[model samples]
Target: MTSPSQILLVFPVGECGGAESVFMAIARHLDRSRFEPAAWFLRTGPLVEEVRTLGVNVFLHPITRLSDPVNFWRTVKAGRRLIIDAHIRLVLSSLGYGHLYGGIAAHQAGVDAVWWQHGIASPMNLIDQLAVSIPAKMIITSSRVAARAHVEVFGMNGIRLEVIHPGVEIAPDHPDRVASRQVVLDELGIQPGKVVIAAISRLQPGKGQDIFIRSASSALRRYPQVMFLLVGSEMFGMDRGYELRLKRLAVDLGIEDKIVFTGFRRDVPRLLEAIDIFVHPATAPESFGLSVVEAMAAGKPVIVTDVGGPRETVIDGQTGLIVQPNNEQQLSEAIETLLANAQLREQLGRSARDYAGAHFSQRTMIEKVEAALHSVLEADTATKAQRHEEGR
Candidate 1:
């Protein structure tokens, strides 16, 4: 039997976000016999703990700033040490900055790199493009839009790009959906049987929580029992002031009591179970709508902005509804329609869960990722052999 291929996965973010979660999921589920995975983060955070809990080897590297000369050298030194110590043949980078630093470090330490593009945006700098080009055997992206963006902006060849959509675990039916709803409602002191319209996302401007709040206010005038739930935290250095502004807006709209803010929840699946409708009104482009999928997995009818991966995930009028980005009227109308029709909501929710189960399971994601890694390694070896033969 062949020995396991050792890989060093590098992440640039300090906190656990969507990208960090995706890395953790892969590290947790990757085949141990075929691949030995290790993680290196720029700074220690909650994700470090999460990675370690999954039995993956985790290391911390102090990165003050990418632009600082002293920090850059330190980063290089750390990268070289980790690559050598871990016996890593491949370095997997999650974002652009991670790819840039990790690629240089892996090359210095003599290992191939694979840049995993999680965002819709392409690399902005020439060095970043070259770093990915020279050292990386392949590039893995999550969305077709991202792949197209890479080719259009950077002239990236199609051969180098591989699209792998992230997957989520479907939660089992909660035995205590009513009790769980009561627990959350009791904590918020909300009345029983209130219509809960929840936007379960990180409290950031790009997430369009402000628009959600405005829409909720409009919806509440027609249905006062409707309680708006904003269930997430501003952990990713996204505008903290946006959360404050949302609260102030709720107060100004005279619907502060109707709006509930639950910060940094650990029980998202359970929270999704409690929510009646899941609404995602992101103004910025989401490469993939993991939260929307998660909500669907939990058997909630979802409504998302008609952009990016949401369009791919949510089938309008079939699985869920898609509204124009930043259009509060459209968002409000969708929520009202779902709320008014229990039969339609049940039909869409069942369809959404079925679609999510078939398409976005964790097993599918792990298998696809394994295939991509093997393809890259095999191609790299063949190319090297060809070069050596040509030289001889």
Candidate 2:
């Protein structure tokens, strides 16, 4: 099948978050001969460099703030110029003001637009709704629940909504497992044969890092060799209070030395390789649990909170365990269970890896994204032709 000539993606953040990860995966794995992909980010950060390293053209839009009227219009003009100069046929946006700006700019440039929903934040304003709903040919959501939320909360039923699950690449084997385990263990001053329970996510209250630490405190008594590895940095602009709080909680519980904070490590796939078990105890709804998927892809058993997207990804007790969100006791119990039964862990891990490989490969994600883009572009063309006929 033929691919669109050129596609432009606009996103609000510059960091390597879940949506950005999916966007980069799609950009890297998409059929390059058919589709020329470019990206525009509001500010420069890790994602910009990552995308560029993948040989995708990236532009820095440099919007000071969403409320800055002059900068906002300037961004619109810049986006229009990008669309025209690049011969962009489609504009895909992730979320926030970027969606509104990208949709408006695409309309101004006479290009098809799609707003890719990545989260369920606040409702869109009237202007944003019109910019996103009227100018955009379709709305692409990462999950079915997110699509339904778009329709129910924002009243954007006029726009077509398509769900495309994000994908992850499974390593041929846990290639970095040995090296990463040695490095992590050495850095933590821990020895071999210690059970590692790893959870990687941005340090935030909603992410439940504190809950994990507190739960680990109790769980460590039974399994003193168990090391709790917290992998990730604090969220952008958020205070370091959460990180400090977790540390304090661990010290107060007398499990401080057993807990290790590896701040924002780039080798997450490798880190997942080294860990014995993975847990995601997010207190809030996760639109899609990319970290959990990554862990599963690494052939590790997972225990995620039974909320939002994890419910779709994790099959409780079969693939991995799913405990109630914010229940530290239950979380600890699940972790201990996986640690105690090596055979059960191996079985679940194998199932997880197989399930992730079958359902969440990068190729699968790119195909779904390409199909959505094709559908949106074709629908736009048909709508234009109908309008022309009616005018005649």
Model 2, CA-based lDDT:
0.83
List pairs with backbone clashes in candidate 2.
none
Candidate 2 residue lDDT tens string, 1-392: 76557999886778877887887777788788768899988877888888889888898987786668899889999999999998899999886466778888898999988887787534544544544554677877777777766777777657777888888987797455687778867766778888789889899888888889988987988888888899988865676677888888988999988989998887787677678899998998777889999999988999999768888899998899999998999998998898789999999999999999998888888988888887777787799999999999
Model 2 C-alpha RMSD to native: 2.5
Worst 10 residues of 1 by lDDT: 122-131
Clashing pairs in 1: none
User: What TM-score, over all chains together, does every model reach?
Assistant: 0.94, 0.92
Please list the C-alpha lDDT of all candidates, in the order they appear.
0.84, 0.83
**Once superposed on the true structure, which residue ranges of model 1 sit more than 4 Å away at CA?**
122-134, 157-159, 387-392
Q: Per-residue lDDT of 208-253 in model 1, one digit per residue for the tens?
A: 9999988988888778788888988888565768788889999999
Best candidate (score: TM-score) = 1
Minimum summed lDDT over a 10-residue window in model 2 is located at 121-130
